[model samples]
Target: MVPEANPRVGQLTTQWQRGKDKIAAALISLVLIVGVVAQAGFAWQVHLNGEEIGVVKDKASLVALIEARTHEVEADKGYEVGLASQVEFRKIVSFSSDDAEAVKETLSEGLEFGLKATAIIVNGTEVAALATLEEAEGLLEQLKSRFIKTSSNLEVEAVRFREDVELEETYCRVEDIVDKDAALNVLLHGSEKLLQHTVARGESLWTIAFKYQLGVSSLKAANPNIKPEVLPIGSKLSLKLDEPFVRVEVVEKQTYNKSIPFATTYTTDSSLWTWDSKVKVAGKAGAQQVTARIVSVNGKEEKRDILSTQITASPTTQVVARGTKTAPSLSTGTFLWPTTGVITSPYGMRWGAMHSGVDIGAPKGTAIKAADSGMVTFSGWNGGYGYMVKIDHGNGTSTLYAHSSKLLVSQSSVVEKGQVIALVGSTGNSYGAHLHFEVHLNGKQVNPLNYFR
Candidate 1:
């Protein structure tokens, strides 16, 4: 009778057991999923060098806070600033949220802050710092550009700093950072010290200013009481020195035109004597354009590289015809003007004495040529004629050059017409720089204007 239990009860008990087993499995699965999620980090905590600093919702939130802090520091410092500490992040499972504003406030007040800037360093020493890399580069460019010369004849190709310059991105204190103007001043003048100069005897304003590379007007402007005509001895004068500290190198492409000297060619003919010659073709100078790469430091040229040379015009060689005929005539009997100048003083005798010569006005170093082909009979210093040259032609005429700076021919050298024999000078018995030319006919002094072609 006990084994015959109710069939409905047995069925109900088995169903309840199955329901309980299903609920337990679901609970276990939920616990496992919770455990897995807990293993994965849900939040990030900030650390400084291994010490826990703070926590944030996410990396993006942390970054936003940092940026905001940086801007805040900029507003307060009147310049741009970086975080002072080495920061790192670690993941942790936590549900608590961090106050972003509180973290930023802590950064501004409690933590030491620095500006993230580019520093111009030389030889591992920090020279200056700027807000951005562009500023840094522009500062250096300005430094180099100061040494560049801009002109139609010069094209600046490149500019650079000669020093071993380095731009390092570093986080430095606000006090350590320098403005562009301040940095430039440091590189150019190096100090705020004033310069002064004491005047000595025989030192004029122009000479004193020139010695210090300053303009006379600037010197005068600096000291008002100082007079230009009379500089007092032992006077204290203010001088502003323009001295540079950095070495800036500049590359320039310079274009210049040069003249090519024409060569002379001679040909002999049987009809004329060996001393007789005629110009067949006139000589012409050529022109060439040269392009050179000039390297300079601090406005002083250091090196030059010839890049290209273009011949703009070809030179025409001068051709002259000579004769081999041996005749009794050695002179053409005609003459060319000694030099290209105006006849300043005519041959006369009205100056209480015999002037005896004509004066040709020319530059001091102008070339004086032979009037006619002849043999030089006298060349040296004469009493009133400071360097003198006398040429005797086979005809009855002789030419003389007086008051010359130099004589090219000796006593026996044969000269041709238009040959440079001396330089124009005011050597003896002269009022100014001029060529004292004279002509002698049968040993008698005559007017020199009567014998030129």
Candidate 2:
């Protein structure tokens, strides 16, 4: 009645609706599949300047991957890549008075690189930095910027790199009831290497090499950068020797005692005085006995070979006296006036000020003589004393001859009493040819006339 329509048309419309639903479901499934495939294809890679280094799966592999990449880069660049294990570094820094604490705090924050830092300081001021050598240079720059306002200078003392490699190993079994020691020998001889020694204090490169039956040239060649003429104390030098040498525990203890003489000029009267013998070196334990005579000339010490060392427990101590106990003997004869001169200034207070020494007027180039038997301590232009010569007489007495035209005796040269020491002239703070002479007792200025008679 309601115009009962075509059943075939109705059925066709239902089929069309079902086909559309199927198509929609297929599109959704395809989208999900594409998303999963894309995710699977994703990867993390590192690159420098668009050049791929390597691929890493996740964050956990970052450190190892980076190290590998760096190694690869080093190889390509032909860089001599020092193993991180072998490197050591040190640093020294100075900070201003106000910013010392802040600078220290910044340094304590640790370096960006994975290296250990040990700081040594004096009064909250850092004096030394210890770390790996590779990290030293870069960290130094960073520290410089950080403490630019606080510190004016910084220094690095020693950079060290060392490594040990183990190459091969082998196992051996006893064969047929031979001596156990013989089997041990075979095992030892199969793969053996020499033991090396490091050059230590009081030890020469040649001596160390010779002790180990090694070649001196070989040792020198190994240490190419080290100058043979100027080997620093405690430098590590190489040693060569055949294998199977016994490790000798040679415990040697040496005590060295040295006497040093110090003299100071008296500020009051310009007199020179010598203090008691002071100990220059305290006794210490050493691996071997070292005995040498050191002569100090002009504040410089020259060491000469005295004796070769031997291994001993409680070795005989080396005693070096600064000078002989006997005072320098002199012919107690009246000394003639070094130059025909008139007294320009007396050694005393004048013009409401202290006149340090006696000034004698003479023509320039007058020869000056040593007042007593002693060593020439000073012969140079002093600030206000002009060209000065200080002589040390052994009995805590000394003399100063200043304002000289020429110096005759150099510092530390032994001279006889009345021997020519300098020439009189106007040199420092002088108006004309004159000799300024003063006497000192235990480093305090006294009247030159007290010792003149």
Query: What TM-score would every model get versus the actual structure?
Result: 0.39, 0.29
Q: Candidate 2: where is the Cα deviation over 4 Å?
A: 1-336
| lDDT, model 2 | 0.53
Clashing pairs in 2: 86-162, 88-133, 89-131, 91-129, 96-150, 272-440, 273-443
Candidate 2, residues 1-453: lDDT per residue as tens digits? 588778799899999999989989998898887676555544444333344333433323444434564466456533323223211111112121223333223322321222233332223433233332333334333332322222222222222111121111111111111232342232223224535466677777767767867677877776677777776776776544334211111111223443333333222211222222433334444344445433322123333444445544442243323433433534343334555577789989999998878888878888888877777767788987899998777666778998898998887678887788889888888787899888887788987776556
Tens digit of per-residue lDDT, candidate 1, span 1-453: 568767799899999999999999999998987886676547778776466667866677666776787788779877656677666777778777578677556544544567678998875777788877888889988887678777989888888776788889987777677778988988776543358888898888989988988888888887888778987888788886655556788888999998999999998888754446778899999999999999988788899999999999999999999877543324777878887799887888756878798888998989999988887778899987889998877666788998888889987578888899999988977778899889988789998877763
Model 1 stretches with alpha carbons more than 4 Å out? 1-129, 141-160, 163-198, 232-236, 250-260, 265-294, 298-300, 305-316, 320-453
Best model number under TM-score: 1
